[model samples]
Target: MQTIVYQIKDAVYANLTNRCPCACTFCLRAKGPGVYGSPPLWLEREPAQAEIDAALDAQDWTRYRELVFCGYGEPTERLDALLAAAARRKALDPALRVRVNTNGLSDLVNGRPTAALFVGKVDCISISLNTDDPDEYLALCRPKFGPAAFPALLRFAREAAQAVPEVVLTVVGEPVTDLAKQTRCRALAESLGATLRVRPFENGTRRFPVP
Candidate 1:
């Protein structure tokens, strides 16, 4: 069976699609079928809007503080479905916060400036900054967009800050991203009106903290 929605800590996660433009070297999907011992996230097929809504409806709203659009792939790969789910969640319970964990390539993926679409649909958006160097990002992430990806990602973050309530850019801690690099990333995030979060890297997987 496909796992559409699952819980991690106080958040309920929505698994939308397995499509992503970049293939990062430290991607968790390469290490295992799941993250933090959840069910296999590789969807047999992308869930439709109805299926996604049904999954959301089934969840006990009182238990989860946030709804996150994140799974084995980039959430923006299915931008429409993601936004629809977030909108529905907000309509059902306005207090329940909604977030999207993304690679910041939505514009390239959808062929337009997509950050403005978030507006009031999502409460927060966490983007992976990875590194401060463009060459390093190209090497580490291996995005299909080649040299254009990094610039687009930065632009997206800048736009997202204006659209979303909380915009965060994250980098892995220690070995993956050193202290000096993390500091630069923090500065970069702040320049774009976003905060930086240094996620802990453990057992080859980035541990995402609950929002």
Candidate 2:
């Protein structure tokens, strides 16, 4: 069966939809079948709310510290469903922290302020900042929303900081190893009142090949 929810380290990641706005050149999906040895990250179709509930209900929730709304796609692409799943998880265990790993392009994708949607439901919001310059971000991310996507993403990050307890802006280390660039990116995220997370780039060596 396709993976709807899978474990990685101390977190449980939910694969709701294989839908995303940006097509980053360094995306792990470009290199393998799945992030870890669970199942193909792809879904035949986006999972329904009932499917999400059943999956969450089946998990040994106490074994994990975080329930992350992330997979091969941008979780906020289906914001309502994401929120509902998060609320369900929270209801199941109020102490279970819920997070969404996103491209920060939801406002551009949905044409509205999507940050407020996560207010009380999500404990942390991790947005992919990618770069410090707009042109470079546009070139690398290739978001369907066009050049305007960069600023819209920053705006969403700032808005999310006010709603979620922990708001993080992330960059892939491989492409952002320059100390100066990383420093600038960190400063930029700090300016928006969000923490910067320089995540190690996965080259898919840890990924299992599809049969």
How good is model 2 by TM-score? Answer: 0.93
What would the per-residue lDDT of candidate 1 be over residues 1-211, giving only the tens digit for each residue? 6999888889999999999999887777887778876889999999999999999999998888999999889999999999988988898899999999999999999999999999989999999998999999999889999999999999999999999999999988887678999999999999999999988776434543222
Which ranges of candidate 1 are over 4 A from the true structure?
A: 204-211
Residue 144 in candidate 2, Cα distance off native in Å: 0.7
Q: On residues 54-140, what C-alpha lDDT tens digit does candidate 2 reach at each position?
A: 998998977899999888888888888899999988887999999888888889878889888887799998888878999998888
Clash counts for the predictions, in order: 0, 0
Q: What is the lDDT of residue 134 in candidate 1?
A: 99
Looking at model 1, the pairs that clash are: none
